[model samples]
Target: MPELPEVEYTARQLRALIVGAAIQEAHVFWTRTIGYPDWHDFCAEIVGRRIEGVRRRGKFLLLDLSGDFFLSIHRRMSGNLLLLSPGWQIDTSLRETDNAAWQTRGPTFLPPTATDVAYSRETSHCRVCFDLADGRRLLYTDPRKFGRMELWPCFSEAEALHGLGPEPLEDAFTVEHFAEELAKRKTVIKQVLLDQSVVAGVGNIYADEALFYAHIHPLRRANSLNASEIDALREGIISVLALGIEHGGTSFSDYRDLAGKAGNNFDHVRVFQQDGKPCVRCGTLIERRVIAQRSTHFCPTCQQLIAE
Candidate 1:
């Protein structure tokens, strides 16, 4: 899943590319990708509307369109939004996948040969394509089919986001508020951080990185965190997320910017997938364990668990 920083960077790049671009038409290859108003209605309503602004809430990319409509996209697992420059046309032959499309195992749902051509030409998972008035085409590609697109008249009407927690990078997510939220849960701190209702936009990657930086074990009970630990945890979350945005995003797999480029943040990760490697802060080898059904990486020496 593309978490907060990935979505935020995507929104910023999209805002710069398509804020004033008008939607001339839409080509829906997969109807299930539309979350609201049915595919037909969604396509009908979105045409002719100029994108006024682009922003993000949690992991959802939001676009303010003409006539007060809002467009929201959630890249659940392996979705990416690609924007192609003018003079580019879809190659019809690229739409057909090889017979071994499903037999091969890879990071993206796209065929193994997908890397040979420009991203825009690969239509294996291009679920939705939008033709802009300026001749550029925006493609929403999702190999796993877990992503979704919703068109709402207003931001509040999107029921999918009704219960999300506050954005961690926003002023509303303070240490006091984070501690208060943690106090209400007895589960492990990592699970609490992953809970969308506790702090929006944080997923497995950021959660692991935050715990490593805060010197807290993922197995530690949420309520066991003291004031200083809580403060450190809050700062850890903010700093790691900011750094992720600074590097574009963590592209361990699948994730790509509008230009089909991978993010550079993966080089800066401390413990997300650093299992068996020596810890950056200490020489002890980092370990990986499954907590709350997610792969968690941490340093045993640096992040010892409290007996509580």
Candidate 2:
């Protein structure tokens, strides 16, 4: 899933690319991708609307359109918003022909394979297509079909974000707020952090990295955290998320930006996917365990759990 930083970076790039562009046409290859109103209504309503702004709330991308409409998109698991240039073309022939001549011709002459040709095709599960007035095309591709696109009035933005917690990067989300919320939860700290109502936009990856940074074991009960531990966790969450944005978001798999480029944050990760590697802070080997059915990674020597 594309978490906060990924969605934030994508929103920023997309804002730069399509802010003033109007939608000439809306095509729904998969009807289920429409989360609000009928698909027919969605298509009719979206046409001719200019994209005024692009922003993110948690992991949801909000496209402010003309006439006070907001298009909310959630890339649940394998969804990606891809932008195709005005005159883009796919050379399907490259995959069909032998292409041995090009192979030996040089690296610059190498053509895209059949896989590349079909990456953004309808056959590749491109659910929705938006043809912009500028001649650019925006595609919503979701292999799992779990992503959602909904159209609603701008006045309903509060309702749309009602259940989500405060944006961690916002000034309203102080350490006091986080500590107060933790006081009521008896669940493990990792699980509490995963709760959207407690901390929006924090998925498994950030939770693991934050906990590891705070030297708090994933299994520690939320209410057991002391003042210093709470402060450290708060700092860790903000630090990692800011770093993620700086690197354009982490891409372990499936996640990519508008240009189909992967983020480099995975290279700087301390323990999210480094289970067998030695800890960066300590020499002890990192370990992975399943907690709340999500993979949890930590250095045993640095993040020992205290019995409460």
Candidate 3:
């Protein structure tokens, strides 16, 4: 999953590259990826529209068009918004036959073999590709077929964007707010962190990192947290998320930036995916277990449940 930092970084990059650019056409290879207004109506409304701005709500990317419409993208798991410049081909296999130099390269598109299942562009899982007026192509790739694209008439509180929680990076998400939200839940702290309504865009990666940093066991009940623990959690969430954005987001898995580049945050994560590795803080072996049916990682010694 792209999570908050990845989506935020992609939005910022999109704002710089495509804002004010007009869409000449849209080519959606997969119909299921379209979530609203029907594919026919969607393509009709999107073509010729100039992009106004790009923003992110939760994990969804919103492209504000010149008209009242804006496109929202949810990169469910393995989804990526990659750009293909005028002469660039995502599959570098073409480079093998041509003498043209590869101007820029970030991530590979087509797989190495047919058994890899990236068969062809028309049959490939690159769900949506938009032809921009500037001769650039915006590609939406998802091997798992979990990416979603929808055209909204307007940004309505009662419409498609409903049920979203406050962005942790925003100034409005104060320590009091995070603590209050935690106070209302009796589930394990890890589950509370994973809840999108509690705080939007947090997933398994940051949840584990935050809990590890706060020294709170992932299995600890949310309501069992004391004031100091809650305060520590609040700081942990904010600080970790801010650092993730600074590092351009974690890319240990399918995530890649606008240019198909892997982010450097994966190297900075202290707990998530570091299971069986020695903890940097206390040299304790980090452990991984399931909490709330999600893979949870932590340092058993540092994140002691006895605090409750």
Candidate 4:
């Protein structure tokens, strides 16, 4: 899934490129992923609208359009948005072209050998595509079919986003509020961090990283956090999220920037996916376990659970 950092990177980059651009064409390759009025009506409502702005709330990409309407796109898991520049050649091997071009995966690296070229030319997994008047095409690609797109009249009218928590990167996510939300449940700290209603956009990767940074074990109950521990956790969340954006979002899998380039944040991760490695600070062997049915990595020596 493209979490806060990855989705944030895409949202921030596309805002400058797509804002003010008219949607020359709107096409959906998979109707199952369209969480809107209807496929036919959605095209009718969005084709000519000018994109007023682009912003991100949690993991959702909000595209503000003219006529007070918006298109909310959730990248979900394994989904990415790629912008194709004018004169850019899509893969020639693709034949299912329509209003949206059936969005083939734009070539990542130029194929070197004969075997690689044949495979690169037939890239699929593009679920939607929007052609801008400037001749640029914005393609939404998802291999796992987990992402979704919704067309709405406005934010106030969208019922799906009624329960999102505060953005951790925002100033409004203070330590006091963090403690209050923590008290709302007595679950383990890792699950609390993963809960969208407690704090938006802190997924499995960041949850482990943040817990490690705060020196709090993932299995520790939320209410067990001391005042100092809560403060450290708050700082850890912000620090990791901000640093993630700076590093261009972690791309351990299908995540890519506007240009289909992999992010460098994965290289800078402290405990995420660095299992069986030495902890950066304590030099203890990092470990991995399953929490909330998700793989978690941390420094067992640094992040110790308190006996409750």
Query: Which digits, one per residue and each the tens of the lDDT, describe model 4 over residues 1-308?
Result: 87899888988899878899999887677777787778888888899999999988888989999999988989887888877666544443434444334433422323445544443322357677787999877888788778889889885544857778899999879888999988777888899998888898989888888898899999898988889999999999999999999999998867878877789999989999999899999899999989878898988889887578
Query: How many pairs of residues in model 3 come into backbone collision?
Result: 0
Per-residue accuracy of model 1 over 183-256 as CA lDDT, tens digit each: 98899999998998889999999999999999999999999899999999999999999999999999977788
Q: How high is the CA lDDT of each candidate model? A: 0.86, 0.85, 0.82, 0.82
Give TM per candidate: 0.91, 0.89, 0.87, 0.89
Positional deviation of 292 in candidate 1, in angstroms? Answer: 0.8
**Candidate 1: clashing residue pairs, number:** 0
- State how far residue 216 of model 2 sits from its true place (Å): 0.4
Best by TM-score: 1
> lDDT of model 3 at residue 243?
95
Off by over 4 Å in 1: 91-117, 120-123, 155-160
- Per-residue error for 126 in candidate 1, Å, reads 0.3
What lDDT score is found at residue 181 in candidate 2?
Answer: 95
Identify the runs in model 2 with alpha carbons over 4 angstroms from their true place: 88-123
Better of 1 and 3 by lDDT: 1
**Cα shift from native, residue 151, model 2 (Å):** 0.5
